[model samples]
Structure formats: structure tokens, C-alpha cells
Target: MTSPAIPFVASSSYPVRAGNRVRPLIDGEPAFRRICQAIEMARESVQVTVTFMWAAFEMPDGRGSTLDVLDRAAARGVDVRLVFWRPDAETERHRRNAFWGSAAHVGLLEARRSAVKIRWDRAHPGFCQHQKSWLIDAGADGETAFVGGINLNPHSMVAPGHHGEGHNHDVYVELAGPSTVDVHHNFVQRWNEASERLAPDGRWGAGSETDLPFPTRIPAPCGGATVQVQRTIHAGRYCDGTAAPGGHAFDVARGERSVFDQYRAAIDAARRSIYIENQYLDVPDIVDCLHRALERGVDVVLLMPAEPDVTLPVSPERRAVLDSRARLGAFANFMLAGLAGLGADRRRKPVYVHDKLMLIDDAWATVGSCNLHRYSLFGNGEMNVSFAEPDTVRALRCELLHEHLGRDTAGLDDRAALELFRRIAKENRTKRDAEDPAWQGLAFELDAATHVG
Candidate 1:
């Protein structure tokens, strides 16, 4: 299939490259199932980068814990490598161990005899290493990649459209063809730098100074779509290497904020519609651009969590979470909704909107770990993959709306679909206020100003 023409100008930070096949995997069941399958089929190696993980999370489908699956793959002679963010020493007391610092995680690794390599990477203090991706069969034919915001929390293991305690609505894309090469490149880049940090102590899972080699060239395209792998990486974090200037989809500089630039460009160029599903909607520049798109008669729809989860302190003092909520309360001129799930008992429960996604005019889309917050936009180490394929964007948009509205967006244009969503959301709010039994699985308007305060 020929790729659709992009109406907007592409950012120099992430130039569009062609020849990729991408499939949107909704919720944890499908995403994790596919991830395990790819690991099982790996011919050479599997590389995974995750910001947060829980030792308690077992695959809900009975395949065992995440480590078990990876161990099994490694036992088959597949090289399995993982990198998890190691919390700074000061903040370690208040957070769960994402690395080998905890006895349980170390014991888990020690028990497994497979040649699974794990590394702990430290990000710029006070920020997170918040990119999550999985690459299988790197540097070979049949290579594939999965990228998005699905974390290792048990809550994220729930299937789509189901009501469970701590239910979440998220997305991950399974990619094939040349796009996997970029994912492979990112993993190697981070692993190399992380190894340098570990070399001094000869600990933290960096057994040797030599790390995985960067792919000498981009892999051959296995399909029809085009992709641009983008990132927000601070300078000096990757001390061992730097991205040279030019047509590369990412930049290595003192402050490379390509993810933010891409979001601004995509929103500014939106013509007919804008659809977003994210955990936070508080970035000033992004909000301003969305407001302008609204003024231009673009239909705007945003989905966020009805209740913010501040279960852990993202900062030393745990004040950033509150600040984020305050910032979210200040947006205007855009239609916003808080999504909730209904149960068999007809109870309304918030379905945590953990997806970082945006669809502009059904012609452009992005999916990954970067949220619309200052920390994510300009401070953290984040990654996102975007494409200018209308059919793929439209299908993913329809699928998400259908899950949120409990009906298909059949025969509706992008603008019409958003408008219909607005109507259903308003009606659902009224029904909930009236104690109506039918207000089960609909999104309701959010009073951003009053929601937090």
C-alpha cells in the first residue's frame, strides 16, 4: 500500500523514514501476549527497556511472571537483555526497587540459569528513564519491536473493556521491518552509556565495559508504512556517544526535545480534528497549540484519568504530582473527558488513561511513553514513534473510541466522530447525576479547573 501524504511539514528532529509494518495492540492482554510470542520466536536477541517494573506482576494469561518468560527464551540460547532505571540514592528509600537493589529481584535473577543480562541505568537525578520498548531478533530478518506506555504493574495486565481493580486503558504497537532497527539502535545506545556508569564499581549488572554494538545501517523495510523514531534526551546522559547532526530521526544535544517539537508541530498543523488520550494534559505549549487548533474549527477531544494516581513520589518531596494536577486544571477551549469502566454490578470505576497518543486529522498519529507534562516534554529520557499513515491512524482511532463509547465510529469522519463522542459524554454525565443505571461505560466531561482544587 502506498503511504498517505502528510499535510504537515515534518520536523528535522525526526524525519519520516519509509518501510514499516505497525499494528496497534490494545490493553495488556494482547500486548503482553504478542511480546511473549516474539520472545519465544527470537533467533538472536531480545532487548527490553522499561522505566518501572514490579516483581509481583505475573502474566495474567498464566504464562508465569515476566522474568519467567524471558528466562525461557534465554534458555533457548536467545540473548535476552534488560535495562531498568535505578533510582537515585537519595530517593531510594521511598521508592520500589526497579533494579537489582532489592533482594527479591536479585534472587529472581540468581535463580534463573539462562544467560539473561540485566543492567541498571541512572538518569539525570529527579527525572525518570521513562521509555518502554521491546526489540526481538535485532539486526536480522523477522525482527520486530513493541513500543508504548504499558508498564509492568499488575494493574496494566487487565484486558481491554474489562473492569478490574486499578483497571487501565493503554496501547502498544507491534512493529516489523526497518522500524525495529531504530528501536534496536536506541537500546544499544542506552546500554552502552549505562555500562560506562557501571564500569567504575564493576556492579549494577555491567559485568564488562564492552556493550552491544550499534547497528551499522538501518535494517531493510519489511512492509509499506513509514516511521520516525523520536526522543527527548538530555545532554551528557549518554557520555559514551553522541548522535551526529543530520537526517537522523533523533538528536543528541545539550537538551534534545524532539518529542515536544513533534507534538507542537503535529498539533499546529492539525486541520480537521485532534484526538488525544494521555495521563496528563498540562504542557503549556501543547495546550496552547490545541487551543489554536480549536479556534481553527478543528474538532478536539481529550481523554484523561478521572482520578490521578499519586501512589509513588516521582520527585523527592512528592509535590510534582499535585503540581501536575494544578496545571491540568488550567486548560480551556478543548473538549475533555474522564473515562470510567462499568462492572457487572453497574458500578462506575475510573479506567486509568495511561496511553500517550494523539491523532491529528486522522492523517498523523504518535504512540509512546512521552506524556504532555514538563518533566516528560523537556526533562526526562523519553521515546515516541510517529507515523503519517491515515488508514492506520483512522483504524486505531476508531478502535479506541469504540472502546470508550461502547459503539463503533462507523461512517463517521474524524470531526464527526469527536463531536459524537462529546454528545455521548455529556449525556452520560447527566445520566450518572440522575442515578441512571445506563451510565456505565461512557466518558464524561472533566471540569479541569475544579478537578484538582
Candidate 2:
């Protein structure tokens, strides 16, 4: 079956840049602002892929609203195309309250009437288009792509302990280099595939076919920066009523393998140091990887939420995994204790890694939705971006390691180490509780654990 032609710009006509400082937007406000700035500066087309989107008029800085801006941009002859996951109408109530409602659908409907294109990613039922990114036209100069875990929703931008609190930690990268093209290409592929499936005879929704128009070519930014685009997709399940002739589509195991392969390749390439920040640190393979790296004399530091979302009662199997994680923590403590013994005066520290990020060799870094757990790496639809920019990567690595070591200098006394660890645990726990009152018990447990010994 011949697929629809994917829109593309001639590579030769546009100039590309390399060796640029890829800024990491740490908070949601910065991320949203950067996105708006890129959109405002867009001269031709805009493409956005997200897991969820909420329609709201009230946003920080009164930056006019998400829906209003998108509509206006489309009206100005800017080719705007958005691909998003379509949640079941039944779940709309819960989703609407959680922040990301059917805004993508609503926004797309409005845009479609205005001659803008919209596509729903019906790749796999129950699985989502979990990538959060946007590509804006930089004219013939180049394009800017924002890739990260931040969903385009209001709840994500609020502070950690606000009235509508959520565990909204994320990192986004703004790319104005060669990597942006690759990111743009990926979006085109997914959009085209979605458009095909959403056709009248296609298998997306039981309705009349709709065609979304998009640009053929986008300009490339001229500079020196290399960025690599990586993604995870669900291939086994047939969401479009199409069977995998090779039987490869029936094997859910292959998706798991792909995820593991990507992660292991990245981990094996690390030289010097690996810093990660994640929501969960319970995955055995990931833990083992760090342990092996530490044995090889690589500096590994992780920042994680003090308490995980296992606050609601869990199954015996899940409980077992959590217990095993605690045991692993004990093992890490034992290793650190041995290291402390050798130094005599230096303090020993237990690793409580979180925050789902990793910076290696001060040149390569990765940030995304994949956690250090089997469910995230192997079971669910996840997205991550990995790139190398010496200055930015090195700066982030230094900042994280500085906090881990308790100072800018190398010498860290035992007292300081203990205090630092305690503070981290305490702050994370407090934040978790403030987000969810049910997490109060977890906070207490964290405090007790830090106080013990």
C-alpha cells in the first residue's frame, strides 16, 4: 500500500548550524516561555506532538492563551499541525480535572475549520503519543524544536505545592541546529502515519475521513550544533486493523528489547560521569548499571523524588519490588560505608537517585519520560532526547555533582554529607506530601529513615 507523501524541504537549500549551547529549560515557566518565543518567531510552519493538552485562557505572564495563540498563528498563514493522543470520551471528566483535557481535539477542530491540519495518534490503544515537543519554522534560516517531557498544560507550570499541585518535574531542550531537522522529520513520519489511519477507510475513528494540510519544507538554522533524535514506539498491537505480516507486530517483546537496547547503548558509552534525576529509581537493570559503572570508577550521581507514587496500596509483586529496591539501597550504603572507611574523615553517603536525567562526559545528556524502571523502559510509550554540547552538558554535570559532593571543592566532611542527604530526603518528602495529602505517611517514613543511624 502506498502511503501518503510526507512533506519535506530540500536539504541543500537550507543552511544548518552545529556546536550551539542547547539550553535546558528547568522549570515549566521557562519552558512555556521558550516555546511561545519560538512560535512568535516562527516564519513558516509549526508542528507539535504531545501526550495531552488542556484548553485554558489563564496562563502565566498572560501570554494570551494556548488556544488563542495557536489559532492566531494558523490564521496568519503559518502552517500549524498538531498530533496528540485522543483519550476516550469517558475519561474526559477525569482528564479535564487533571489539567490535560480534550484541548488538543478542541484546538484541532478549531484549527481544521481555519484550514490548519490535525492528526490523532491512534498507534496503540491504551498507549499514548507521549512525546512532548514542538518545531517552529525559522524560515530559510533554520528551525527551533523544543523536546522534553513537559506536556502543554496549565498544571505542569504551577509550583510544586500549589492548589492544583502535581508532580510536575520536567526538562526541555531548545535546538536550533542539525538535530532540529531530525526531530522535525520524526514528527512528519508520525503525523503522516496518523493521517493515513484517520482516513475514511482508515482505522482511527469511526467517522468521515479528514485530511490535514502541512508544509513541504522547513528552513534549517545555521550554526554548529549536533542533536540526535531517539524515540520508543509500540509496534506489536494493531491499532489500525492492520496485521503485521511478518508476525513481528504480534511480539510485544520486541518493543521491550528496543527500549533496553537504546538505554544500554547510552549507558555503555558513558565515560567520566553519569548524573540522573528521575521520579522513580526502582528498576533493577538501571540500578545494576550504576553499580557496574561505580565499580569501573565512573562517578554516578542520581536525584530522585524522596517518595514514589506507591502510596496507594499495591500488589504483593509490586511490594516485593519495592522491598528489593530497599535492599539494593542497603547494598549501596554498604559500598559507600567501605569507601568512607578508606578516607577515614570523609563522610559516607547513600544513593537516593531520582529525576530521570543523565549527563555523561560533560558532552552528552538525556532527558525524557522514561524512568529507571521496567514499566517505563519496557512497557509503556516513552520519549527521550539525547545530545552533546560541551559547554551546556558540562555546566549541568558540574552543577549536579557540586550538590552531590556538598560543595564546589572536593573535600566533604562526614557531617556535611549526612546533612546534605538528610536535607534532600526531607525536602523531597515535604514536596511529595504537599502535592498529595495521602503521601504524609511516606514523608514520615522518609524522615525516620534519614534519622536512623
Pick the lDDT winner: 1
- Which lDDT value does model 1 have at 34? 86
- Cα lDDT for residue 288, model 2? 62
- Highest TM-score: which candidate? 1
Global lDDT of each candidate? 0.74, 0.50
lDDT of 1 by residue, 1-453 (tens): 222354433433435678888899999888999898888888888899978887777875688888888878877888878887876765474357365346666666666643677777767777778899999988887888999999887778877677444788889988887667678777888887773245443233333345777775566776777788888887777643433222443445455687888888888877788899888765657766776777676778888888876443355333544454444334333567888777657777677889899988887888999988877888788988888677888899888888888878967888788888888888888876776747635588776554431
TM agreement with the true structure for every prediction? 0.89, 0.67
For residues 1-453, could you state the per-residue lDDT of candidate 2 as single tens digits? 211211111111112234443677765676787788777777888888766666553445777667566667877878777766654443343355322324454455546454445566543544445667888872335678787776666546733212122335556777765556556655655665663353432222222234433233434445444444455655562222221111112222234233345456556655555556666655556656665665565554445543344422446755555554444343332111100000123322222222357666556677766666655665445656566565676565544434343244224322233334434444544544464332211111242122111
Worst 10 residues of 1 by lDDT: 199-208
